[model samples]
Target: MNAEGKAGGFAPGVAKAEGALRALFPETPLQENDYLSKKTGARVFLKREDLTPVRSYKLRGAFNFFRKAIAGGATDGTFVCASAGNHAQGFAYVCRHFGRRGIVFMPVTTPQQKIDKTRIFGGDFVEIRLVGDFFDDCYRAAHVFAAESGGMMVPPFDHPDIIEGQATVALEIARQMHGESDARIGDSLVILPVGGGGLASGVTCYLRESGEPTEFAFAEPAGAASLQQALVEDRPVRLAQVDNFVDGAAVAEIGAEPFSHLQDFDARAVHLVPENRLCATMIEMLNIEGVVLEPAGALAIDALKNYAPETLRGRTVVAVVSGGNFDFERLPDVKERALRFEGLKKYFIFRFPQRPGALRDFLDLLGPEDDITRFEYLKKSARNFGSVLIGIETRNRANFDVLTQRFDKAGWAYQDITENDTIAGFII
Candidate 1:
């Protein structure tokens, strides 16, 4: 079916899909958030898809895909998927729920926390295979294996059924908004995070088909803005490089099926969030709301920063909190990124004279509020000079400016390497 024809039937189809999903778990909450509302000057609500059994909305799509496949009496009853994150857990959960054997192919670089969770969800019903280092490698391997084994493949996104399944989120949003006294979805703006575009595309298509005058915005990781690139180029294009920090949404390319539904959106409507800046949002939610959000999960909420408070004033806005499968082990990295993004932390490489009190002299240049977080002697670069790596944290960003002026006056040969991606990647 054509995209338009498929979209025409989405309202009823999504309603049915959402009804069937209740057998597995109740609908996720759509709660009003005062913290966000006050920050943006908008009446903000959060569609909490993070509360699902697999801690992601991926479960809805996986369940619907399996449910339809079983009903159609197709093949030998085994299903397969390739995912390094949320989709794998969702697929595994559905596999066990349906009592069907399944195979999950994940990149070998996937964190053990995610791998262990997928296994626990699927239990004995699913077998996991660690494939290559990247998702594309595992994806190709899964397809070849499915072809040879005659097993059906359940895609992470891209398939029509998966899109329809994800549309249920919007279906519930519309109903829930109506129940909240005089709140109409038609007058609201919905913000969704874009990865391969399943959730965003599905939600937008369903809401559009419902004949609501709803506005929409999209969020994508700045490091992997595939949907924004597709909107600009008028076709889905593979990104040359992707930062996997936001692993759940760092798709190299937007899925063709999802792009078809999303292509008409203006590139301006899509906000590209920096990976470092996203960490600040995650920490904000964690500390203030006691809400844990994975990097990709925080995309929608972080995009709110792109809007001026006056622009969103008095408007009803909904931001989808997509997932919360955070591994606590990454907290230090997250905190480091957040501090850097906030400009309160920096790193520098200094050429220090191999003489007495050189370290004391450098320390004397620092502001009262500046604290040395890291200091290491890399090597003796010359007979009289050694290379020292120094990290500093301060109460204010302006302190760095004063410190840099002191470095120049004191005749210190130094390179600010905080923003140097290559150097920071290697040494930080």
Candidate 2:
């Protein structure tokens, strides 16, 4: 594949960026995984961006932004960015690498582990500031601080420098494929996980420039499908609400610059990965392959399920594992989500008779495989009945169908609140 014609369209810039990246760390590995290959009936390669210096590809973009700012005569010696997780860590790592002062404003609600990781990465080169409870609040504070202190503000995405830096990942892929003896680089499928679209945009541009006849697919969290929305509207639109479960990739709005590069792709090429289903993918990787992945990191891998085995049979596919900064504290929640998505767990609101024997009667309906995970009584609605919240976990999903039938036959009143977001939000 020829990469000589293009100068600015991710070809020249990304090549230079790739050379510069060697100063910080070697290229992340692109290893073929037998597990995914067997599942899809395709040769699957994982671009393990999770193994990056900051445990994400975010370092590539942040480093490039700082490098250009310093080299292009930016007078400000301090850099500032607002992030709750991966971006903060990346920016801090780059600050330390370049011996520059950095101020990272993060939400007060950010986990201690993430905050500590950012501090460890930046060491003496960066200052951590806890601002507001939400990302928007801290983002506003970061802008104000940057303006007041005359510090250069680095955006998590939305900048050309950041995009170019991220394009280096694609450049590495092209180079690595070229070196592989059995790899068919030209006919491969490249699956990218879309956050703000920086990584996807950059990689697509570079791969096109490299003249690789590769097919591209994008995966976005269903609750935060900013990229898909942008493509649909032919312009970027801010979502009223975005689920932050896939924190690394949950963007309410796609970046303008990235959208410009990515808008050409067809809407059908993007897959919306459900947050709950993503938990299953994350657990599968962890339990089977010993790979720990954050929600967004599992996006591309989960997307492989979108295609049938026949469609991908004998094909070479690459899934970008975006990051691995998963907090073990959230493991229980991850497992719960996975079970719920798999239909092995459910929540119910039951009207129990206000009698001593009523509780025992309800418990008697349970099968041998059924277990009560949570049971709480709400306020009594009447003198004879009380509202009870019950969470059930079963070995088989079929048990729920039988249990519901038994409840109906016994004239027991119950409401399945497992998928009622509003009710679950308040009490669960």
List the global CA lDDT of all models. Answer: 0.93, 0.92
Pairs that collide, model 1? none
**How do all models score by TM-score?**
0.97, 0.96
Q: Which stretches of model 2 miss by more than 4 angstroms?
A: 1-9
Any residue pairs clashing in model 2, and if so which?
Answer: none
Evaluated with lDDT, which candidate comes out highest? 1
Which digits, one per residue and each the tens of the lDDT, describe model 2 over residues 1-428?
A: 11322444558878887889999999999999999999999999999999998889999999988888888887456899999999999999999888899999999999999999999999999999999899999999999998988989999889888988898889888888888888867889999999998899889988887787899999999999999999999999999999999999999999999999899999999999999999999999999999999998999999999998899999999899999999999999999999999999999999989988898899899999999999999889999999999999999999999999999999999999899989998998
lDDT tens digits, residues 36-134, model 1? 888888999999999999999999999988888888896356799999899999999999999999999999998899999999999999999999998
lDDT of 1: 0.93
Among these predictions, the greatest TM-score belongs to 1
